[model samples]
Target chain A: MKVRVHVTLKDGVLDPQGKAIHRALETLGFAGVRDARQGKVIDLELACADEAGAREQVDRMCRQLLANTVIEDYTVEFV
Target chain B: MKVRVHVTLKDGVLDPQGKAIHRALETLGFAGVRDARQGKVIDLELACADEAGAREQVDRMCRQLLANTVIEDYTVEFV
Candidate 1:
C-alpha cells in the first residue's frame, strides 16, 4: 500500500519561504497572485497492503517524525 | 480562486532527504516501509476568478518558477 502525508503550517504562522515565492512570482510579472504558502508531501511505499493498518501507521509516522506539531498539521491518505 | 501545485522529484533522482527519513523511521521501530520520497506542495490564492484562466496562469507559473522542470515534475490543480 502507498500512503501520502501532507504537512502544512497552521494558519497564523508566518511562512518566509512562501513570501519569497510570491515575491519571485510578482517579479516575473505573474499578476493576480494574492498569496502563496509552501508545504511538504511525503510519499511512502509500504510493504503492508492493508489500508486501515497503513493509515494508522503512517499517521503515527507523521506525529513522530514528519510534522512539527506545534506549528504544522498533517493529514494522511492513501494515494 | 485557490490553486495548488505539487512538485515532485522525477523517478531515479537521488533524494538524500527521503533516504534519511526512511532510516529514521526504521530506527524508530516503524516497520514495512519500503521507501519514502519527499515532495513539495505550494498553495496559492489568486485574484483571478475564472477557472480556465487561473489554471492556465498557474501552469505557466509551475513551468517558469514553481518547479525545476529539469529534475522535477509538477502538477497544478484548483483547490
Candidate 2:
C-alpha cells in the first residue's frame, strides 16, 4: 500500500521558514500571496496489503517519528 | 483563496534525507516500510478568488522559484 503523510506546524507556533517563503514571494512580485505555511509530505511504500493494517501502521509511524506531536500535526491518507 | 503546492524530488534522483528516514524506521523495528520519500508542501493564502487565475499564478511560482525543476517536480492545487 502507498501512504501519504502531511505534517504541518500547529497554529500559534513561530514559523520562520514559512515567513521566509512569504517574504521571498513578495520580492519576486507575487503580490497575490497573502501568507504561506510550509509543511512536510512523506510518501511511503508499505509491504502490508490490508488497507486497515497499513493505515494503522502509518499512523504509528507518524506519531512515533514523522511528526513532533507537541508542535506539529499530521494526517495520513492511502492512495 | 487557498492554494497548495507539493514539491517532490523526481524519481531516480538521489535522496539522502529519505534514506536516513528509512534507516531510522528500520532501526525502530518498522519492518513493513519498503521505501520512503520526503517532499515539501506549501500552503498559501492568496488574495485572489478565481481558481483558474490562482492556479496559473501558483504554476508560475513553482516554475520560477518554488521548485528546482532540474531535479524536482511540483503540483499545484486550489483549496
Candidate 3:
C-alpha cells in the first residue's frame, strides 16, 4: 500500500521560506499570487496488509519523527 | 482561490534527505515502512478571479522557482 503524508506549518507560525518563495514568484511576474505557505509531503510504500494498520503506523511516525507537532500539522492519505 | 503544488524528486534521483528520514523511522520502530520519498508542498492563495487563471499562474510559479525541472516533478492542484 502507498501512503502520503502532508505536513504544514500551523496557523500564525512565521514561514520565512514561504515568504521568500512568494517574493520570488512576484519577481518572476506572477503578481497575482497573494501568499504562499510551504510544507512537506512524505510518500511511503508500506509492507503492511491493511490500510488501517498502515495509517496507524504512519500516524505514529508523524507524531514521533515526521512532524514538529508544536508548530506543524499533518494529514495522512491512503493511495 | 487556492492552489497547491507538490514537488518531488524524479525517479533514479538520490534523495539523501529521504534516506535520512527513512532511517530515522526505522530507528523509531516503524519497520513496516518499505520505502520513503520526501517532497515539498507550496500552498498559494491567489488574487485571481478564476480557477483557470490561478492554475496557470501557479504552474508558471512552479516552472520558474517552486521546482527544479532537471531532477524534480511538480503537480498543481486547485482548491
Candidate 4:
C-alpha cells in the first residue's frame, strides 16, 4: 500500500524558512503575496496487510517521530 | 486568496534526506515501511484581484524560481 503524510506547523508558529521563501517570491515579481507557510509531504510504500492496519501504524509513526505534535499536526492518506 | 504549491523530485531521483528519515523510522520500530519520498508544500496568502491572475503569477514563480523544473514538478491550487 501507498501512504502519504502531511506535516505542518500549527498557526502562530514562527517559520523563518517560509519567510525567506516569501521574500524570494516577491523579488521574482510575484506581487500581492501576503504570507507564506511551508510544510512537508512524506510518501511511503509500506507492506501492510490491510488499510486499517496501515492507518494505525502510520498514525503511531506520526506521533512518535514523523511529526512534532507540540507545534505540528499531521494527516495520513492511504492509496 | 490562498494558494498552495506542491513541489517534488521526479521519480528515480535519489533523495538522501528521505532515505535517512526512513532509516530513522525503522529504528523507531516502524515495521514494513518499504520506501519514503519527501516533498514540499508552499502555502501563500495573496491579495489577488482574481484567481486567474494569481494562477498565472504563481505559475511563473514556479517556473522561474519556486521549483527546479530540471528535477522537480509542481502543482498549484487556489483557495
Candidate 5:
C-alpha cells in the first residue's frame, strides 16, 4: 500500500519561507497572489497488509518522527 | 480562491532526506515502512476571480519559482 502525509505549519505560525516565496511572486509580476504557506509531503510505500494497518503505522510515524506536532499539523492519505 | 502545488522529486533521483527519515522510522520500530519520498507543498490564497485563472497563475509560479523543472515535477490543485 501507498500512503501520503502532508505536514503544514499551524495557524498563526510565522513562515518566512512562504513569505519569501510570496515576495518573489510579486516581484515576478504575479500581484494577484495574496498569501502563500509552505508545507511538506511524505510518500511512503509499506509492506503492511491493509489500509487500516498502514494508516495506523504511518500515524504513529508522524507522531513520533515525521512531524513537529507542536507547530505543525499532518494529514495521512491512502494512495 | 485557493490553490495547492505539490512538488516532488523525479523517479531515480536520490533523496537523502527521505532516506534519513526512513532510517529514523526503522530505529523507532516501524519496520513495515518500505520506501519513503519527500516533497513540498505550497498553498496559495489568491484574489483571482476564477479557478481557471488561479490555476494558470499557480502553474506559472511552479514553473518559475516553486519547483525545479529538471529534477522535480509539480501538480497544481484548486482548493
Candidate 6:
C-alpha cells in the first residue's frame, strides 16, 4: 500500500519560514502575492494487507512520529 | 482569504529525516510501518478578494518560494 501524509502547522502558530518564502517570492517578481505558508507531505510504502489496516497504521504514524500534535495537524491518504 | 500550501519531497530523493521518523515510529510501537517521507506546509491569511485571484497568487507563491520545484511539489487549498 502507498500512503501520503500531509502535516501542517496549526493556526496561530508563527511561521518564520513561511514569511521568508513570501519575501523571496516578491523578489522573484511575482507581484500580487499576498502571503505564503509551508507544510510537509510524507509518502509511505507499507506492507499492510488492506485499506483499513493502512489507515490505522498511517494514523498511528502521524500521531506518534510524523507530526507534532501540539503544533501540527496531519491527514493520510491511501493508494 | 486563507491559503494553505503543502510541499513534499519528490520520489527518489533520499529523506534522512523521514527515515529517522520511521525509526521513531517503530520505537514507539507503531507496528506495520514500513517507510516515511517528510515535507512542509505553509498557511497564509491573505487580502485577496476572489478565489480566482487567490489561486493565481497562491500558485505563484508555490512556484517562487513555497516549494523547491526540483525536489518538492505543492498544492494550495483556499479557505
- Counted clashes in each candidate structure: 0, 0, 0, 0, 0, 10
lDDT by residue (tens digit), candidate 4, A1-79: 9998989899999988799998998887777989999999889999987999899999998998889999997989875
Residues A1-79 of candidate 1: C-alpha lDDT, one tens digit per residue: 8888899999999999999999999999998999999999999999988898888888889889999999999988788
Candidate 3 local Cα displacement, residue B62, angstroms: 1.0
For residues B1-79, what per-residue lDDT tens digits would candidate 1 score against the true structure?
Answer: 8888999999999998899999999999998999999999999999998998888899899999999999999988787
Q: Cα RMSD to native, each candidate?
A: 0.8, 0.7, 0.8, 1.4, 0.7, 3.0
lDDT of 3 by residue, A1-79 (tens): 9899999999999999999998988888887878899999999898998888888888899999999999999999988
* Deviation from native of the Cα of residue A31 in model 3, angstroms: 1.1
Winning model by DockQ: 5
Off by over 4 Å in 1: none
* lDDT of candidate 5 at residue B77, scale 0 to 100: 82
Q: State the lDDT of candidate 5 residue by residue for A3-76, as single tens digits.
A: 99999999999999999999999999999988999999999999997888778888889999999999999999
Each predicted model: what fraction of the native A–B Cα contacts (within 8 Å) does it retain? 0.90, 0.83, 0.96, 0.91, 0.96, 0.82
Please report, in order, the local distance difference test score of every candidate based on alpha carbons. Answer: 0.93, 0.92, 0.90, 0.89, 0.93, 0.77
Model 2's CAPRI class is high
Q: What is candidate 3's DockQ?
A: 0.93
What's the CA RMSD of model 3 in angstroms?
0.8
Cα lDDT, model 3, residue A31 = 76
- Scored against the true structure, residue B53 in model 1 reaches a CA lDDT of 88
Q: Which parts of model 3 have CA positions greater than 4 angstroms off?
A: none
Interface RMSD of 4: 1.1
lDDT of 6 by residue, B4-57 (tens): 777777888888988887888778877677777777767677776799987987
For model 6, name the residue pairs that clash. A37-B42, A37-B43, A38-B41, A38-B42, A39-B40, A39-B41, A39-B42, A40-B39, A40-B40, A40-B41
TM-scores of chain A in all candidate models: 0.96, 0.96, 0.97, 0.93, 0.97, 0.93
**Per-model TM-score of chain B:** 0.95, 0.96, 0.94, 0.92, 0.96, 0.90
Candidates 5 and 6 compared: the better one by TM-score is: 5
- Give the alpha carbon lDDT tens digit for every residue of B1-50 in model 4: 99988898998889987898899999998879999989998899989879
Per-model TM-score, in order, reads: 0.97, 0.98, 0.97, 0.93, 0.98, 0.73
Q: Write the per-residue lDDT of candidate 2 for residues B5-59, one digit (tens) a residue.
A: 9999999999888898899999988999999999999999999988888888999
